[model samples]
Target: MVTDQAGHPLFTTSRDRVHAEGLWHETFHCFVVNREQRIVLLQERATGKKDFPNCLDITAAGHLLAGETVADGVRELEEELGLVRTLDQLEHVGVFLEELTLPGFVDRERTQVFLTESNQAISDYHLQATEVKRLVAFSFDAFATLGDETTTEVVSIEGERFGRNRFVPHPPEYWAMVERSIGQSSM
Candidate 1:
């Protein structure tokens, strides 16, 4: 679906065309956290993915298809990570407008983010091999620190030592919004 700057519906288009033309569309992002441990979940995109392959990203996320509501986005959890959750079980975070430009594709998204608490171990997840490579847990505090571009610290994720560059380069504002959401959810 394509939309105007304010995210009002304008027209519907193919997903490929939307990315190719940088058309704005709705997306859903779910961050599964273990609140008791103050750890957040990150999924490694499959290596064969066309964009940002193998990069650590939100626990589960996908674009919202035309005619689907934000609640339908929860299907991504089951499809990607084999975790079934209902909208009522998730805390709805604020929507954010985000844009990313890569060599062959552009992503302009009006994203609705959500958070859900889960105590499941990383190794217990049933990953969809084609979409997710691995699931790892990281300290929420350490993840927040990466928002600072000047930070030179490297932290280990899974078995890899990752600097900020190792993850997807989402805008700093997006990180700030997510940090604020997480902070509020814990209160």
Candidate 2:
């Protein structure tokens, strides 16, 4: 389903057309934090994926299928990362306009962001092999400094070392907003 800039549902359409035509659609982004809230989870996208393959991205995220409400999107955590969580366990950060245009694709999403606290170890995650490769955690401070030259830490995922360049290149402002939200949530 397509939505207006204000995230009001307008009409239903196929997912392909939504991306191909840059139609606004609803998606969910969940960021997982450790018990102490000092670390945040990150997942590496599967290498075979079409867009942003093998890049480090949000802990777990997915599109809200047509007719799905924001709460329904919580299933993405279980579907993508094997973490089952109830709606009450999640804290809604806010809605965001996330738009990205590639040569052959345009992703225009009205993303409902959520945060959840978990102490689960990365090795314990049952990753969806087709969508997620492995999970990694970064210190909140270090992640907040992402995209800056001063930030230099290799992210190790299942014995593989990935540098900052391997991450999805979200704009600096996006990282800043996420950092602020996470910080506030931690307290």
Return the top candidate by lDDT: 1
Clashing pairs in 1: none
TM-score of each: 0.92, 0.89
Taking the tens digit of each residue's C-alpha lDDT, what string does model 2 give over 36-145?
A: 74888888899988778989989998888878998899998999888999888998888878788878788898888889998888888889999998888888766777
Regions of candidate 2 where Cα sits further than 4 Å from its true position: 147-161
Q: How many clashes in each structure?
A: 0, 0
* Reference-based TM-score, model 2: 0.89
Q: Highest TM-score: give the candidate number.
A: 1
Clashes counted in candidate 2 amount to: 0
Candidate 1 per-residue lDDT over residues 50-83, each given as its tens digit: 7789888889999888888889999999999989
Relative to the unseen true structure, what is the C-alpha lDDT of residue 4 in candidate 1, on a scale of 0 to 100? 79
